[model samples]
Target: MRRITTVLLDVGGVLLLPSSEVMRAAIGHSGIDTTDEQLRRAHYAATAATDANGGPDRVEVYRRTFAKTCGVPAEFEDAVHDLLTDQFTGYTWQRVAPCAKEGLELLLAKGFRVGVVSNSVGTIEEMLATAEVCQVGGGPCAAVEVIIDSAVVGVRKPDPRIFHIALAEMGADAAETAYVGDTARADVDGARSAGLWPIHLDPYGDCPDPAGDHDHLDRFDRLCDLLTSRSGE
Candidate 1:
């Protein structure tokens, strides 16, 4: 264990884990005529790609991304648009659960600098509002120093570049900062690449193995325990 200067967080499974069932319902309702594979491709681009603030143009990003998979006629553009919008609109932030809020409050109050490293699109503010996170406009989330949305910052995770941006914003030494995220390649690999330790969460049992030393958690409910203990140790 090492002294912690900052704690970077992931949004998707770490903050407000989306309901796959709910998202599927929205995509199905969009009336996009496409095969199963194509539909899945389109859905991911719309939701995942937009998570970061600055990246590819929205329309072309998804349109070209899903084109190879869907291979739908020119009409796929309209369908992709409808399906993505519907999916984002269906995002649910279960406030009562509050895994991130609980951990964030503990980190901030303990004097550990905190920041958000989430990939989002459309708007991070909207997601935070739904999640009830108080970091809106950089005031602080129960004491978390700052939140950097990939979309807001013009970058996204898995790029390593975005993590560098987050570290710079936090003014934290890479060795002293730990990034906790759910996705293996995107979060864990990205953190490792950025020279930050990684703590991976696998609540739903989907997390994968990593190549080097790392810690994995089954549930985020005890995240506060992990961070606080890490800093003290």
Candidate 2:
């Protein structure tokens, strides 16, 4: 196997983060009385929105579910999407981990092709634009070479095809490429199955790689350490 020349990452939980406070505040502002029951319902709906069956259109998820939870019929898609966006992606993107950004820059400086391969059922481009990550016409693609969004691609992970697409698009061999994400099934196992090195990002101090090698970590600061520790960098 050759040394790695490409690095793939999962966005949402890693980059976007999961903010409970943000969600609570947004739902409270919806005038929908954020009760315990409402909280549980909202969580369920949000989780379902990510899976395969919920079907991508984030506005539909919020419009239908929020309406039911708030006991309202419906609202315009723009209004609903805006509401949901406030809850989920409303975080200040500038506050992202400096270590994460540094690690990315380090990888890029090492001449490694970087990209994002996320499991998203919503319009990722919209989210990217909202987060100030340029997505059109060769703008800021440096952050992540290409985004393989599930909503747009209509395909989820744990599938070899997704990894194959990434490897091909980046012009890198699977043997030399690597994927870093938080999920065990999707990131580690899937990357291994695709013949790429799997680096699980376990923030909770748990290792999910199953090999017990201790490559799992809490932050992206150690990314260079992992990539360079091996034959790849």
Best by lDDT: 1
Q: Per-residue error at 199 for model 2, in Å? A: 0.4
Residue pairs in steric clash, candidate 2? Answer: none
Evaluated with TM-score, which candidate comes out highest? Answer: 1
Off by over 4 Å in 2: 19-21, 26-98, 133-137, 140-143, 208-214
Candidate 1 lDDT tens digits, 1-233: 57767878877656764444443444444443454444444434433333332355754554344443344456544664466455544244332223567776776666767777877764555666655765644454454556677777887778888888877766788888889886666788789899888887765443335334577765565765776687785
Question: With candidate 1 superimposed using the best TM-score fit, by how many Å does residue 174's alpha carbon deviate from the native?
Answer: 1.0
TM-score, candidate number 2? 0.64
List the lowest-lDDT window of 10 residues for candidate 1.
89-98
* Model 1: per-residue Cα lDDT at residue 210: 34
User: lDDT tens digits, residues 1-233, model 2?
Assistant: 46777888876545554344454455555455455445444433433343323345744664455445544334543454465665555232222332555666677787778887877766555565555543533655345667787766777777877888877877878887888876665667678888888887765443423357535756686777778878733
Report the error of model 1 at residue 184, Å: 0.2
Candidate 2 lowest-lDDT run of ten? 89-98
